[model samples]
Target: MSTHKPLGRFLTAGAVAVAMLATAACSGSTEPSSEVTELTVILANSTFTENLPALAETYKAETGITVNVEAYGNEQLNDTLKVKLNAQSDEFDIFGYQVQDVMREFVRNGWLTDISDYVNNSGDWDWNDFQESARDAVQLDGKVYGVPVATERHIMYYRADLLKEAGIAVPTTIDELEAAAKALHNPDKGFYGIAMRGARVPLVTQYSSFLYSYGGDFQDEAGNSTINSEAAVQAYNTYGRLLHNYGPPGATNMGWVEASAIFAQGNAAFYLDADSQAYTFLDPQKSAVVDQVAYARFPAGPAGSHPYNIVFQTLGINSFSQKKDAAFDFIKWVLNKDNAKLLLGEHTLPVARSSAWQDSSATEKFPAGLVEIVRDTDSNYVGHDRPQLEAVARAREFVGGPAVTAIEGGDEAAVKAAAEQANTEFQALLDTEKR
Candidate 1:
């Protein structure tokens, strides 16, 4: 039985500022108070929660600073952060920001504290340890806004046994991929040719990978929306074809959980999803096709291969935190190679540090194919931004709405029109944020 407790009260910026001042005043007294300083931290409820508290406990043992850690589910954490920011409050000294797109808005609004100086000044901190794409996602202007924790790249996970049985080699191009999907599809046996995330947000992330691969970008380097370009339409049309022809029947409602489950259960021939799923599909305890799973790079599109790679949740210190020094110390300690190794070993999450990736223990735990997937992440990394975010949401809506209509024997012209309309709405949203 899992017992859950209500997370503590949200801290507002005003309240945090008052607390800092109070702590400072108390520290100046002749009789130094022996009371422990409590720092509030809000983190998403995921694999992170399993280990962060233990790490916090270690920090307290060494420094006497007590950390009150609270965990919220993904949507809950985002909602809470937005509400707190809207109220101009800093209830938590440290926040775990998920999507880079959302973090950009937080950075723009001055909600997150800039950690560049601290990272630069720290003798132990190595900025080069992080992947360039992962680091770039958290940077606003020239200042870094967050410390990335884990990064995952999109890849094609296929059943090597099934491919061998079907007499098809591993696919390198989009056409080859489609042919393989068709060859391996067994609908009567509850199998799917391809399993992709079809739920709104998840589907959008999957689409971004393909869209970029097809030489379609959400925005140009100058920040103008490019989602309505011919390349983009082609990418969307291809996505519609996949859903309509080869994908799982219930794909529209499928997210990572469903897609991963389909692959793990050996009911899907191929899965286009994050590299993180490799661990699950290869785990004997969790997967029926543990020995049969094989990974390949994201299939190449007409334009080229432009798979999406993104760091998962990243932690950032609140700019309003009076305990900036303490915060820096905390992040540096947790992100250290030794600590990172432990986290990765326990959670199967990729660490931000490159050195950690080379750890002998890690190599023993993860597969060589998985390591190749991580290394290949550099080849097709695309930083998530507002345009990507908006375009993804719009793409998903258009797909599930009119695209589904077309798939179920509705009007193709109407589906195309709806897709165009969705693109226009997404472009308008992007326009509002342009500098």
Candidate 2:
């Protein structure tokens, strides 16, 4: 969701082809033109989705069905799905969505066709290949609505050469993370300590790791608002201070893409972003510090490093589709081991398959310890990056305002006041949704 802004309209085929590799399957008059079935898929134009046309072409060649792929920006796709699916339009047979952000509304509106039977009845699909956390996220009222497409967690990406120059080891705790940033900071020399997401919306995902590590969250276990807790205040203060004091100029204007670019270009010593962003950093053509990049777990706080390990994207069949079976087939085809291997080869986000992560070919593709960090974090401490409430997108807007202000160097008093106001407003919105 943090790459380029999602265009509100369907993307062009050429645009999708940029990041995708398509292959034609063996076909010699297996089925006549009249017997072809066409299924449409709509998804966000991310690394995974952009490359999906390749799988679609393979599916088409296998079954003689024409698979049409349509992609929109993440937010735009969410809004488009909301509007189009609510009307029960059959324009798309299947779609992918941000699970935590949009599933609540999609489930409530009954726009998704439940695919539990497809999951439960298929053994070769190795339904168990998916991690439990990922499987659980796509379910609603104990029924599976979608198949998880992409899963990720926030991890630390640092300049190994810079750390060595500073005579420091990789940070393991919140205090060390701060020290590392402060020590490497040299504004006069045009280098920053850290490159962090600060734009209002995308900031929410980055802040979640800090918030959880400090033992604060959007709500308590009982679902009451905890945005104004003492831990909340401290977490906000620490995050704000790190960026305002040691971050690049105009830090508040940056999201993951901007911040990660700064890190990849060697302007910052450390960057906090999703693991998928590492692809750009590792690509020599896309980065200046490719060989200097290294990965680490999100630095631990007093509560330990509880990063958001979320199945961020999922594919589902539309309830209104006349081609639900074909849609499910397409979903299966895309996530199968061979296709996942292809995605891994492209250095995209690691998928939900444990076996995939353990594959030698997949492991050897990246920096030494990335797959290990991805594996450990995936199996250990991870949660939803955001709340799964009906009002989540709106909630992020209000709840995230204070962090944005703090990162912009607002005075302590003003930042605290903003948090207090956001707490009340956020609770009110959550309460409205509950009622």
Report the Cα RMSD per candidate: 7.3, 7.7
Q: What tens digits encode model 1's per-residue C-alpha lDDT throughout 1-435?
A: 012222112223432332232222211122232443767788887666656777677666655778888999888988998888777665567888875547766776777877776666554446777777888777777788888888887888989998898789999988799888887787898888888876645566777776787887766777655655667666666766676677778776778998789889988888888887776876688899989999888888997777876878898877556565566556676676566666665556687677667776755677777777675567357766224442344434543443344344334565567556766766576666663
The TM-score that candidate 1 achieves is 0.82
Clashes of 2: 1
Give the best candidate by TM-score: 2
Highest lDDT, which number? Answer: 2
lDDT computed for candidate 2:
0.77
**Residues 1-435 of candidate 2: C-alpha lDDT, one tens digit per residue:** 223222212223432332122222212223333443887889898778766676666556556778889999988998899889978888888898888877878888878877877787655566778877788778877899888877888899998988898789999998998999999999999999999988787888888888889988889866777878877877888888899988999887888889988988899999988887777987888899978999999998888888877887889878887666556666776776655655664544578876677777766776766888866755445557775578887888877888877888887787889889999998888889888
Candidate 2 lowest-lDDT run of ten? 19-28
User: 327, model 1: CA deviation in Å?
Assistant: 0.9
